[model samples]
Target: MVATTAPPPVERVAPQPPWAAGLSDVTASDASLRRFLHGLPGVDQVGAEARATMLATRSIKTVAKAWAIDLAITMIDLTTLEGQDTPGKVRALCAKAMRPDPSDPTVPRVAAVCVYPDMVPMAVQTLSGSGVRVASVATAFPSGRASLAVKLADTRDAVTAGADEIDMVIDRGAFLSGRYMQVHEEIVAVREACGNAHLKVILETGELVTYDNARRASWLAMLAGGDFIKTSTGKISPAATLPVTLVMLEAVRDFRDTTGRQVGVKPAGGIRTAKDAIKHLVLVNETAGDDWLDPDWFRIGASSLLNDLLMQRTKMATGRYSGPDYFTLD
Candidate 1:
């Protein structure tokens, strides 16, 4: 792992917004930050896992299933973040986001298309006026091992390229080392660099190792100005598991109750099939309540989830099981 110096503590130089009411009230001292984070509710691992398992068994049929499929389509952050990503691929992803299914204009488009910083312009150009926003994963995504300056610049570049949202990875090393203040400062800096774009802080929970750490990371990100707290970068194993997501959901639910600020949650990676998608919805409805069921408060970061949803929707409509050839190769 790469070593880098932690940035200085973030001072409340900028005025806090109305939504930042509770978070801004907390002192920036390391001791205070640690006290607040560690003092939050502890996760009952067995209870959480059992709840997730029970929720996954929820059954929906006919119209409700169809509605869920459509809702899932709208919440997708259709993503393609790869070293081999090109302009053509971005444009294709944009196209898929816009229409999703060519034969069905009635299908609602996805929430946004997620890509790397360099591809932001191509995505912006292609998605312009389509009502589909462009989201870029920045701040040395997946690893987030770069210096603070590099990470902020990476975020700024994507915003300058017209990205509507920024998904940034937190330095797991800092979090694991108990540098709560440092991790908080990094998120605040990236949130500032984002300008008007929404900031989705990627906790990369797979690397965090424990439910307690994931809960702590979720609160840390939200308190530091994350509009959304995402589970993974979709680049690691054990990404976006039901139990892990349940922990994040509980965190958001508790945060909203105390802060009146509703931060979104995105469970990226390992989510496929209509059944899996609907189960997530069930989890959302049951845990976070109906308010979080909207796309504004929840998202699924996936590359192939849209195709599966399309196939299921087609199946529901035509009463026929359509093969993979039916949908676009996004």
Candidate 2:
């Protein structure tokens, strides 16, 4: 067989890294990107899980638990991405997001309502004037299987529809195959498509196969100007577990320290109850500090999590569990 040759390198300029007075872009080329990502510290998987478990098990005082329940409500990206989702369903979800508990007006609205790109107009119309943002998943969500032009069009359409945020998935195939520049440029291009909207870069960590890849993907997303480095697309198994989130929390915490720009961390999928949400809040506080505890700096992407949070909030106030009839179906 004839000798094979690698593809020619693409010339790209990554968004400038957050820097102090005397620094410059460190990941301007493919070789430097590989060096930079590879050079970052590796994760201790067993230790990370052990610590995540230990932190998850920590108990909060009754008073603090009540506070956490509400905070989690405020951070939820109330989502509905089913194939059969209709305009009426999107409107209903928006209504739930704005009020959460119809009888108890004290319950705060969610941070945003996450939906597919096609449903953005309905979401925007329904959530208008309410503080809840409309977040659309783009870049061939769940699979990240599409061309750059398609992904850019996906992002722009959502933004034009008045989506306040765009959740974009990175090309995990390129990432896993070690084509770092390909993945980086896609994120940069999508970030531009987002325009005034915030960009949440979904790593879909379950496909990444290792904690090291998750950590590297986090740094890569942050360096590429992702306003948030999210853990998953909420479409795969093992989505948003505590251990995976712990590694991401550490990555964001350290990234902020190095660059002085704090990027958010969101763990989507598989988080379905009040207890699980609280555990993540504790993890964020203990691992990333209280600075990340706010809705502005952190978000939980889920479909059923809001109902549980409302139920728990009611239980806290009434000292009894609210039956299934108390809340609408997710």
Candidate 3:
């Protein structure tokens, strides 16, 4: 084991980790960063898929299932990102975020309400006193095919609008073409642009096409000072899956072990069912242990998943499941 050094308290600074001890110069240049990222242990594709599949099958029923349901509820990033989004829609989403199931006071608020930069102010305003955070997807979200200037401006606008969190997509074009340093620099710049808001770096793993690339991207994001590394933008097919999330959970677990800076993991996109959310919680608990189980270290990005969680929560509390009509759609 390389003798790793300690990082300054993350509360005070955006920690740009020095790789690990002897590998301090890993991010010094393009070539070193590439070599270090590529040199890290390769993933066993079959084993990873099999392990994730096996873990997903583990069941949590009744009382234990209820606990997982609430935990998953609190981890949601209730999102509404669309070209047709209106201020009223954002306001409604914010209301749902603050009090997901209005009938159930025991139900916990979600982690945030994710929207476009233009909608941040409305979300922030509605969620002002509520513990629910306002997260705006910036840096040309869904498709990060914009210039650094544009991306930085997008991040700045969201933060200025009182967004508590910023979700930025990495340039898949740069990353796929072997420009690792460019991706790292962009995340660092966005993190700086985020000011005090937490930065979630979206990897868009579907484009990467492999588990090894996902692991590399996770490390790259953490090194570049992202508070959280996300799985996808939720606009594409094959959005957050168990195996992909398992690999990311492993990356964060290993990262904290080496750098002593605990970055978070979020699996966004396509996870709409309560069962899917619970599977992810099982994966986190079994792989990353209980620490990543909180809302701070883990997040599930979805708009419709909240309603399903509410339905399940109602079923657990009452003898029968609540009708889908009982919950307001997001």
Against the reference, the lDDT scores of all candidates come to 0.88, 0.88, 0.89
lDDT of 1 by residue, 279-299 (tens): 998888777776788889999
Tens-digit lDDT track of model 2 for 187-261: 999999899999999999999989999999998999899999999988898799999999999888877766778
User: Distance from true position, residue 102, model 1, in Å?
Assistant: 0.3
Q: Per-candidate TM vs. native?
A: 0.92, 0.92, 0.93
Clashes of each: 0, 0, 0
The TM-score of candidate 3 is 0.93
Cα deviation of 32 in candidate 3 (Å)? 0.7
**Top candidate (TM-score):** 3
- For model 1, how many clashes? 0
Q: Best candidate per lDDT, number?
A: 3
Model 3 whole-model lDDT (C-alpha atoms)? 0.89
